[model samples]
Target: MTDVMRCEAVADIATPIGHAGRVSSPVAEFDPKRVRRLRRYTWWSVVPMASFYAILVITGLVNGFADGTYAAADLLVLGLVLLVLTVEATRFCASTMRGLGQGRHHGAEQAAAFIAALLTAGCVLATKPEYGFIWVLLPAILAASIVTNATVSLRWPLTFATCGSTAFVVATASWRYGPPMVPIRFALIAAAVVAFTIFVLVVAVWFWDVVLELDRARSVSAELAIAQERLRFAAELHDVQGHHLQAIALKGELAERLVGADDGAARAQAAEVAELARTALRDTREIVHGYRRSDLATELDNAREILEAAGIATTVSGHARSVAPPLQPLFGALVREGATNVLRHSRALHCEMSILTDEHGSEVVLRNDGVYASDGTSGSGIDGLRERFATLGGQVRAEHRDGWFELVGRAEEPGRSEA
Candidate 1:
């Protein structure tokens, strides 16, 4: 939001008197729709880990119930431990997915981990001797998941220590309380479960991180493009005005020196200075005019590049020259504004621009498939286009129909006689 506001403020300062009321720069607004879509993607990526964790919790509870050797007190203790692990796991996952700068709730996470570990020890002590290390699987898996959420510098070492300790505890408990043959096998199984759980949790966190990085990169790329455009305009203005201003300055000095000494020479130099000034003024106007005039073919090509960069497929049809020359600029503005809307306003997957012309009039239609909803308001850019087209006996309209958002503009052929 600060970046956008800064750009808008600069634009306001730079705008000419005639353009003061024009629509704001397309890049000046942040796209909440795109942000929300990315957020949804982030949440969905975390679902697999969450679902697997839930399934394991349920399985543990069911297994304890089926093992009838456990008394009511033991079962109650196991349930409470599972509940604490579940709450901690939830906190860890939330903190990891929210990314950096948001609070990680380290105190709560530490408390949960401590409580879970203590409860696991209780379960280990209370379970029947024959059951051995079976009750430890749930807490072991939960602990590994929580540990993997550690900062990058400590994640792997912490995970390894957690896994090794879990295995050793399970092995010792089995040897001390279970059938003699089960210790080594149960230890290996415990290690495998913890390793696999950590792997899944790690992959899910990595996926979420990648999505966030991509989003940040996209924003940086847009801001860079805006900066480059400003530089280009500045360079062109400097190029156009620099030579003329220099020559005018030299001529004015000559005219000043010649005065009272050579009246005729002074008048000639003054005329030259005036001519240079007029030429500079004219050239500056031309440069500004060319800058403001949008060309249909150039805009179409640009739109294709931008949409493709954003992962949206783009198709542009119909020749630029086929549109009446007078209407080309209008259609070009439509294309540019349409592209901006498609990107910022919708989760568009595909975009199509079609230019159509005949003896009667010219038309350009932009279509995109990601229309979620439309409240029938076309926004300031489209509203401005509508007013411009209306002055020329043409019309521009935005419509949402048949799962597509369409911006259509039509204008009569210039110089065509009325019947």
Candidate 2:
């Protein structure tokens, strides 16, 4: 009964929006971390009243059992009151934890409050001589109302019922076949009861309102983060494509004009168009990837060194330097991929790479002298390589034949017509 509300973090532990006031079970739809935290908050919330009630009952029980004037009958009455309390307390707890729903179930909350108040009054009245002043149970029951959401509507009937029940308990005790306690004692108990009921219910409902507000704040924060990302994407896109598109339009107009007048010059302008397209594609990729961080020569050198250290003789001959600047990443990927295959699917003594360039195209042939039947298909890296090379009229292929594994690839000159 000496417990005061330590509401420092009560709002933080109140039900969040997702599982607020509508879960079918205690263990359902609740975050384990949050649930654990809520459980503690709930303990703190109820212990003050519940623990105080327990001490009051025990005081009544012991005082009754000690006095010879009220041994057997008062013991049986208090025992019956305990049974009713056990059932009502369980109901009250379930209602409190789940959060009493709104108007849809207002009747249940009313019934609970009225019945609990009557039972609490009965416990005190049962030991009238021993249980003095604890008649405050009547008003306490009225004030300890619960709600799942922050909505309170005062009903005149419920107010009448609670007040009437308190009066009935005090009147019955005063008018009973004995010298009654003074009138001031009844007034004090009635005043304490009414004051606590109002205080407890108001504070309890306000805590949950704060919880609902916090949930809304979290939702706003997430939406703001998403808006910031979209703005960044838009700004980067404008910066990358603005000048490139203007240059592409000029080159296209030049090619169109030359097509009728000078065929050779038009062909040259078309090649410039292909180069411009490649540059735009690269710019877009860089924006998405955060920046172009790989160079084919560097990757090839790293791959060759890695494979050689693994006790495999590696001969890398791909002239990544000969490929157009935009396509170097694809050749670099081929070198890295060849090294990975040698290490993972083959116990190879030798790995060889041949970079061949001709008038039509550039090809990288990666061959290793070990064959292990494997489920490793062209995985994400190879699929990405295929897409990247396809943008510039190129492709990659793989084969296994007689203890030899070969991956061969080519990216044709950009302006070359596919035959």
Candidate 2, TM-score vs. the true structure? 0.49
Q: Which residue runs does candidate 2 get wrong by more than 4 Å?
A: 1-42, 69-77, 90-106, 109-113, 119-129, 132-135, 147-150, 155-188, 201-205, 208-212, 215-223, 238-250, 292-419
Question: TM per model?
Answer: 0.72, 0.49
Per-residue lDDT for 1-419 in model 2, tens only?
00111232223222211111331211111122343455467646743454456467666677757876456876686567655654454345335543333313455665665566565565456456456446455345433543222244544344444555565566565555355564335644664575566456445534543544444443343233334334665777787788788888999999999997999999998899889889999999775433345666665555554444333556767477887666666676676666666766676767788888888778888888877776867667667767776787788888887778888879876666654
Candidate achieving the largest TM-score: 1
The C-alpha RMSD of each candidate to the native structure, in angstroms, is 8.0, 17.4
lDDT values of the candidates? 0.65, 0.57
Off by over 4 Å in 1: 1-67, 98-111, 114-118, 129-134, 178-185, 255-282, 289-294, 340-347, 367-408
lDDT of 1 at 67: 76
* lDDT by residue for model 1 (1-419), tens: 01112322443223221121333333332343555566676656553354455566556556656877656776687667657665666556666676532326474555457446635743463455444344454555455555545667667776677677667766776575557667777767777777777776667667656556656555455444445545666777798799999999999999999999999999999999999999999978655533344567766766665555455667888888898777766777778678778867888877889988887888999999888676756698888789878877899989887889899999997668474
